[model samples]
Target: MQTLSRWENTPTFFPQFRAALLEHVGSSATVVVIGASDGRLVLPLAAAGHRVIAIERDPVALQGGLVQLPDGTEAHAAGLVERLQQEQLDDRVDIVESDFLDADLPLAARYDAVWTSCSWHYSANHHRPLADFVTRMQDLVRIDGLFGAEFMMPVTARHYLSEHYTSPERLGPYFTDGWNIQLTLRTGQFTELPHIGQPHPHVHRMGALLATRTSSVTTERA
Candidate 1:
């Protein structure tokens, strides 16, 4: 793995996601990663022959900045673009430097797979409904393409009040008809160590879903 100083020590699925992608899609599929922060998922996919459309909004995660690590030491971090260039994987990825939902993406530019990891639970995303976020991401996947997301399930009291923090079963209705659900996984509430963005211990429950879009279903869009 090409290490990004800021993102170092962040526990992320590296080759596992790649392995899953290979099992579902053929080699060299085009994948759109919804929260491609600091090249964590993007670089690995790119290295494994997948062309990536990485959408990110955070300048610190996208560009670069000084930050404290998970281990409590401050270090200047390499931006996603810079890291891509360094790893020579820049050509394999198209970076959308804007909020995922607000980014100007043509509907025709669908991908083989659309993915997000722990996105949308942030207060920044509270402005939009959870359905809006899922619809937008799912819309980007071509027929028979994969839709994958690892999301934070409700933990705190306020989390239960909001629809954004959800579980795999709770998110099932969004897939509608003709979508084959391939996977649904969840992790029990667990404590996460302090990291750059999160400077203190935090408890969280996470859930993931991987489904395939077999055919289109007409629905009202927000």
Candidate 2:
């Protein structure tokens, strides 16, 4: 096992995201991960013998670069690309270092599973409506493929007004047909320890949804 750096040591915002993958995603499957920062989930999925297409926007997060730690010290740390290379998992991943929403992804691309963690909730993506994000992710899934997302639910008064900070129940209307919602979970507000960019303690509520598209375009239109 490779030793993890401070930033690299950070656990995923959604703990069950991996569990869902292990239980639902098959071995040798090809998975697409949105916001795959620094191989947090990418490395493990690759290590499990799955091919991963990681889309990350930050160049520093995609490639090793200087970073300021939570303790207010600057240090050079390895990124997803470097970690994958060091772990000999480079061949298993195709790293796309561009904004997930704007990246010129191949139209033919489809996967066994597509996952995003606290992605759309970011202010950076607020320029686009939340539905746009879900639609894009949905379009990328093949029939019977899994669509998983762990997001920040409304924790503050201001969050309720922003559609981006929503829950699975609120997103239900998007599932017109041929979609099976396997599980939907939410965590009540909890305080989290600070790390890297988030240098102070904060409270957060999270939500997760695991659904599968049951029919393809041809089948849906039939």
Candidate 3:
């Protein structure tokens, strides 16, 4: 596990990932940002004219800058929200301080795109099955909506390793049911990030996936 501080400060493949997401979802679309600790993705989406719902569980991140969601949950990310306010983007951005897996999100708020950046594995850590996690993610998207995620997984599987860490190739089967997988790449470089139990940086293999929901089991309102 890693702290929210690590997520906020660490540099990853964010620049390129952001560009790809924007291109796929287009401007002025409704977007749901999972694990939006500091509005990195939310600020950009709102700035580009999209209405964004940013979800983060860390209440500490909500300090200084706070916003109330429709359900009355308060979310904070002082620096980023302040920048959005300076750009006059408050009206288009909704911040929710809730756990993505368990939050009782409004079904009517189905989004055009659901994006999680390097934080999706938190579900597996919480004991949720990977299949169920994938299902929950796809449920948030409307028909033909986009889903994108970038996560770190183990390169070589070990018996003692936590189930939360999986091979990059293992992610493929989960997206096949009703998804049009657009991009699936296992990165070549070993990655390092701060971990809770380790004094040194934890290293792992990285993976990125982008898929589109081709069919919806439930009705969605546009």
Model 2 spans > 4 angstroms off: 5-15, 22-25, 217-222
lDDT of 1 by residue, 37-68 (tens): 89888888888898999999989888888887
Higher-scoring candidate on TM-score, 2 or 3: 2
Cα RMSD to the true fold for all candidates:
2.1, 3.0, 7.9
Task: Indicate the residue-level lDDT of 11 in model 2.
Answer: 33
- Per-residue lDDT over 45-151 for candidate 2, one digit per residue giving the tens place of the 0 to 100 score: 88889889999988888777988777898888788888988899999999887787787877586778889888888888999888788877888887778888988
Badly placed stretches (over 4 Å) of model 3 are 1-11, 15-17, 64-83, 122-124, 155-160, 191-199, 217-222
lDDT of 3 by residue, 113-160 (tens): 888777755543446655655567778988778877777675555612
The candidate that achieves the highest TM-score relative to the unseen native structure: 1
Per-candidate TM equals 0.91, 0.90, 0.74
Ranking by lDDT: 1, 2, 3
Q: Best by lDDT, which number?
A: 1
